[model samples]
Target: MVDEMQGERLLATTEAVRLIPMRHSEARSGRRASGDFVPFPVDTTMALAALTRQFADSGKPVEVTFRKLVHWIRSGERSSHYLHPYPGKLLPHIAHFFLANGTYARPDDTVLDPFSGSGTVALETVLSGRTALYAEANPLGRLLTAVKTHPIDTAGVAVALEQVRGSFAKSRARKPPEVVNIQKWYSPAVIAQLVRLRAAIDALDAGHQRDLMLATFSAVARKSSNADPRFSVPVRYRPGDAPARPAPMELFVSHLSANCARLATLGLIDGLGEAIGAGNDARSLKAADGSRLADGSVGMIISSPPYAGAQKYVRASSLSLGWLGLTPASQLRGLEERTIGREHFAKASWGKQHPSGIACADALIAEIAKENPSRATIVAVYLSEMRSALTEAVRVLRPGGHLVLVIGDNTVCGRRFASSEYLREMLEQLGMTVVLSLVDTILTRQLMTRRASTAGIIATESVIVFRKD
Candidate 1:
């Protein structure tokens, strides 16, 4: 939580630099530039302006080749991307690079993101003046994407926010939703504040405005909890050992105000193509109307798929899930199992080994199973699921459209798991021709600097571009 005095200083400093042009990394890192320190705050228009500065440079001479593209783009995010906090989001520049480049996809063309984690690709697509189509397995991610891409009525949201603020004291505390080990995650005072805030938010008419408030509430739900802030996954601190934090309602109001400003800035963009959310599963992508996606319908597809047993997206979202009343604690495992790269499996399914059909992948699985059979099964399942997802991606992409995948390698059972290689082989078998493959050094990521014993630091990521034959 931001301290009150510090928050005031931040607000003042943000207002001062609102007109200055700053680099993406410089603004984010709070580096001293031209003898003035610019720190990243929750201010909305400044962030929007900083991101737009990158787009303004589109007129400069540039080539589309990988070597030229690498230097042409930089990591930055639009204001809407800050509407919610999501783990392992693809850097906005990567998606912007593909969408803005006329060779891969042009304005008004439709782009699809099957994984759509937090709608990074979708937001970028819309900003590039292309229609954005996406499907996300996690309900929280889907909701976030929906809110991020849509334009918000700032005046209406502000009135509603004030009403919510006034009603908090009078709002009755509703019974908390069923969350596993709830006591370990939140204190009584925090829970009371959250439930009351939930009640107030529920009173509003159901629409985009309500969704904006809900997204803000969800962010507060995570920030005000006992979970350790350093780690992506929830790690509860011992009772009374947790540090002091801001009140839940205070956090909600501050975040909602900032988010509203962000949405207003997003609304300034003209001719932003619509962002549509397809159904949950990537293996069988569909349209928002529940219609099947026709073959060769999408002009391009871009995604950074979940790695094999490396991320715990479901677990990371469990807190928000319960607070939003989307899923109860008991059903989290079921939700986890449904995702592509889950580590857990039923005992019956574990007994049988499934081959990914790639000789090298199967060989690696066999080598892993010699020591930990269950871990090996996780790897096999990950590969199998990705194959299905990729098949669907290829099925919907236009013949000449490109499929750009940003993936990285990780360790499984203490051995190197070449996931990027496996994906390339799988795409090839599906008849997709590899066009360009570039490896990027990861500067910072959601995962710990040193990951758990089984997984090591993912130092680099491979960006592979493929075209359907």
Candidate 2:
């Protein structure tokens, strides 16, 4: 069995900030009416950004307590956030606080999320009237982010969904694609139902509408499978005690309908900006015009990066990848190789050992190597890749642009690793000044606490903000 111990790191943290709304009365009044277009809440990102102007002028880094900022409550599931499930989602409120306040980004300015998982930041950026550019290694994630941020005619979606539902009963059962160990994760009967649905979805003309249907199908594929629904990664449930699952077609119809409603709400927003996927690799990103993203062109970046050996993102989405025909069983490992914090590596690469170039990080790697050399290599490679990603991020950010990272610490090799501290150090070395750092306890997130007998709980997270020099 692959060690789950190494790939279970805490991810995506946000600090509580007091929201001092400039137009508090107007913002609050919109929420009172049902179905009214409530603007993004006025919050601390603007307040803090305004407060930091004096320091920005003098070129000094300023730190402040997060709780001292103003506060307000907003719904996290308002837009396309509830479209699909994703591992380690950052709270939408956190993204809204910064994006809406114009602290770092203004209307029509481009904001980037280098590790844009499931489009949380991208959707927020679009809703805030700024163009969003994102880079994601997972094809499924790229599609999810794409569909979530872009708007489609609801009338057309309604018609397409009905056609799909009608065809599900009559469509021919196509052969299921090779998903590794398909029988282990799904019953033969379930596989037949899924393939029929896939065929029905496939009959549609390819476009955003088709993509939306495919995403809904992917969710149904995961939900109706024999894998445990409670866990992030696929794990077969005990045979006798496994909970009964809904039929795949029934689930897809219902899920797609609700998602359509979510999209309708997003469609109502006037002047909603665009979100473009800049390809799979973050270390080398491109713009919508098919050219390399120009240096010093972006106004802001907000992302929650993966933890080294902490997230099994590829494995978790394997079922969807197979169903969507995005990655086949044969190319699974190849897809994983592009991910930043991937756990697997070539056997030959295990013999290589290099210093991460961060002095404190290097000492930690050496300590971890004494316990598990392979694990040490995984950590080292993760840092090296992140260095390249950060280099790219710094290269494209305008001098005064803000970069926000939501990250958490974790235990590896029985030692506590301060991921926030290490990342802050790396950013400092890259000539980015730390403007704010705040830590908050995680109340609840889409995370699995136990992995076999070794994984530890991720209780708190840190939100670090930086400005390019």
* lDDT over C-alpha atoms for residue 400 of model 2: 90
Cα lDDT computed for each candidate against the true fold: 0.76, 0.76
What does the lDDT read for residue 131 in candidate 2? Answer: 84
Please, what is the TM-score per model? Answer: 0.85, 0.87
Candidate 1, 266-381: lDDT as tens digits: 55555556889878999989887899988999999999999888888898888999999888998999898889988888767763866889998899889887877788889998
lDDT measured at residue 13 in model 2 versus the true structure, 0 to 100: 10
Tens-place lDDT per residue, model 2, 309-416, is 777889989988988899998999999988998888876787386776789888988888777777777888988898889889989999999899888776666666
Score residue 106 of candidate 1 by CA lDDT.
Answer: 52
| Shift in Å, residue 245, candidate 2 | 3.0
Q: RMSD to native for every prediction?
A: 7.9, 8.1
